[model samples]
Target: MTEFVLVPGLFTGQAVWRDTAGKLAAEGARVQVVDVGPVRDLEAHIARVVAAIDTIAEGQDIVLVGHDYGVYPAVGAADRRAHRVARIVYLDTGPVQDGAVALAAVPDQELRERLAEDGDMKGELPVPSREEWSRWGSTAGVSGEALDRLTAHASPQPLGTLLRPLRLTGAGDGLPTTGVLCAESGATIDTVRMLLRFGDPTMKALVRPDVTFFELPTGHWPMLSCPDELADVLLRAAAGEGTRLEAVGEEEAGEEEAGESGYLRPFLLDVPEIPRERRGAIDLYVPEGGHVSEGTESGEPRPAIVFVHGGPVPEDARPTPRDWPTLIGYARLAASRGAIGVTLDHRLHAVTAYPTAAEDVAAAVAEVRADPRVDADRIALWFFSGGGPLTAPWLAEAPPWLRCLAASYPIMAPLPNWGVNDSRFRPADVVAHGGTPPFVLIRVGREAPAVATTVAEFVGAAEAGGAPVEVIDVPGAPHAFEGLDHSDAARDAVGEAMGRVLGRLGLE
Candidate 1:
């Protein structure tokens, strides 16, 4: 028989697992819940879990299950007893990198600082009010009675637990792991895969063969809200029955063995290179016969489309987002269709750099408009990926000169974990208020759930407010479909979207 060791997060302890434990035991599986009573530090918590593991019958299949903050000690114990443990389960949590403190993962800087200050003074952090629970994670599905019980039984979490750096050895390397994501908490299997595509080294371990994922449609505390469902997921996870994520290159290599890299995939329509000019951080591709008459104003000022590439791109990333083939293709394509193509290198090198990056974009727009060969009154802004949120300010109050707004596989709202508290970047919220320029959104069917959810919300809000929105959806494509999907549908969608933006700029 397989034995399961359950661990609880901060505040509520063993009692929080009562329902889930009973369900697991009723199914004839051995269950043990760790109770590190009044523990002041993470080491003490780990010791308690380790003691429980030691009590299990020798050679009995042991699966360690961790919930929320409980994941730390559970993982620590797993590291100490990797050989004896059959598998490890993480509930609504991702792996904490070695030397990372639990408090560091809190997305809200103000809340994090407050918690730290209180923990330092009081020795423990107090439980938040019922209304404040939403800040931690969605409290949906949690019954009123359960909420009361949670509050009644809640205890202050030790400051040390949050501050202590998680120490890991290589003992648990390659240990079979299962992650149970809570969708209401704002992370899903597809979203994690999407983030991994950006090549974040910390999350690379998630795509390994021994790792798998399961998602529950409840809030952060699934044990309190959906104990039965949580139990079933736990059983399936212990049996190694969950979805495995493909690495960044795995799907492409399997689909197109000899083709160019996904990012380097050919553009949907073929267009000859236009005349190119480099000025500062901007690149301008002018259509044939379109030229600036030096020392004299040109007869006709062509409209221009400034393309803003997406990122949290590494500062050291070679060639930058402006030089990416996809951005270049879109720029050249714009020039082919009678509009000047504009691309620029923005400073969105990190998630926290949105403010500065937005400035770079505004400056780029100013520079593009000042060019004598470009129509100052007729200009369009097209953003991709992380650059999507930059559209929020314009959408909130569209300038008369801003002819159109376009986004391809854009993230309209910041992810819950990104810790972005700035309201300026939330396009969905701004669109809800109504007055906005025409929006051309290129949506993909296979987009990450988090990104897709934001787009859906933005469209819904726009429709509710009677704002104009034109959706060009590619049902079989992924997030970066321009380069990843080479089918007719992908090609047609790209061309149509570009034409729509160009048409808005009086370039039909």
Candidate 2:
């Protein structure tokens, strides 16, 4: 029989795992639920879990489990007793890098700020209100009674537990690990696989054979929302029955009929390349004649559509986003439609770099408008992917010169796990301010659930605010359909979206 030990996350007690623990005990497994609430420091928390491991019979390895913030100390304990551990299960949480603190890893940026505002390094953090719980993670499928019980037993998390760094000696590297993902909280095996394409070293580590994943359809606190299912997943995870993650190219090779790799794939339409001028971090594509309708000598300047590529793109991604086939294709397509096409390399290299990325884009726009070849009053900004959130400031208060905005399969709101402050970078909330220019959204049917949820929220918010939004729905396509999906619907959707943007740019 497998011996089991479980650690609960912030604001939670051992009673929160009562149902799941009982189920595990009923299955003939020796169960132990570590009470980390009494501890006010990380060392104490780790020591408590370590003490539980010591209680197991000699030579009998145990399966260790960590839920949410509790994973930090659980990992520490596992590191100290790796030889005595058979498996490590991560429930709705990912591994934090060495020297990282739990407070920085909190899913909600606004909540993180509020918790740290007191500047009390040694103080505890309070539990959020019931309505504010969504900021932590989605509360989908959680019962009212379960929530009340959770609140009743909630404890203020020790500041030391969150403020202290989780140091690892690399001793627990490559341990048999199971990741139990909560799909509603914006964590899924597919998202992990997607991040793998960016070649993030952290994501790359998950490809090990011993590392497996299981995704639950509910929210962050699955033990309360779906205790029976969570219990079963925990058992299966201990048995090593979850799906294994593959590295980027490895997944493609495993497929019998492999499609073109995502970024390398061709654009939806075939358009002739136009004259290109390479500026610093900015590329300008001019129309075929190299003249703005023979009125270049006069006061008439052509409209410019600046395409902002989406990222958190790897700093070392070859060809970069500006050089990607899709960006180049869009720029060239804009040129074909009588508009100066602009693409720039922004500094949105990480989720936290949004401010810098926004600054980079602002500087690029100012530079573009100053050029005599472009009309400053007729400028439009087109965004994609993660770049979607950057549209917030402009939507909040559009300048007279900013004619329109467009986003293709964009993430309108920050997902719960992004740690992005909700007060800013929320286009869904800002679009309702009504000082926005005409907006266009090219939505995909097969977008990732978390992304789709944000888009839906934006659409609903836009409708409520009476914002002028032209939504082009591609029911058969997926996110990044311009390069990934080659069907007629994708092609038509791209063409229609471009025409609408061109029209908004005063090019039609």
Choose the strongest candidate by TM-score. Answer: 2
Residue 185 displacement (Å), model 2: 1.8
Model 2 lDDT-worst window of ten: 254-263
lDDT of 1 by residue, 1-508 (tens): 8899998876768888889999999988999998868777888888898999999888798999987788889889988988889888988877865676777555566667777666663377778776666556557689998887777777877888888878989788778999999876667765566455445565566767778889887777888899999999999988888877653454544533322234445565677777569999999998875433233234578889999988777666566667777888999998877788999999997677889999999999999999998999989999997788899988987889999999998988776556677889999898888889999999989765656777899999999988899999999987667766788998999999988998898777
lDDT of 2: 0.82
All models: lDDT? Answer: 0.80, 0.82
Q: What is candidate 2's CA lDDT for residue 180?
A: 94
> RMSDs, each prediction?
4.2, 2.9
What is the TM-score of each predicted model, taking all chains together? 0.83, 0.91
Q: State the lDDT of candidate 2 residue by residue for 1-508, as single tens digits.
A: 7888999888888889999999988887778899775787787898999999999987675889988888888898888988889889988888866687778657766657777676566788778777777767778889999888888888887788887778888787778999999887778675676566656577777778788889998888898999989989988988888877653353556321132335446777888868679999899997865433333433457899999988787776666778878888999998887788999999887787888999999999999999998988999999998899999988987899998999999988777767787466899888876657899899989777778889999989888898999999999776677877778888888888888887777666
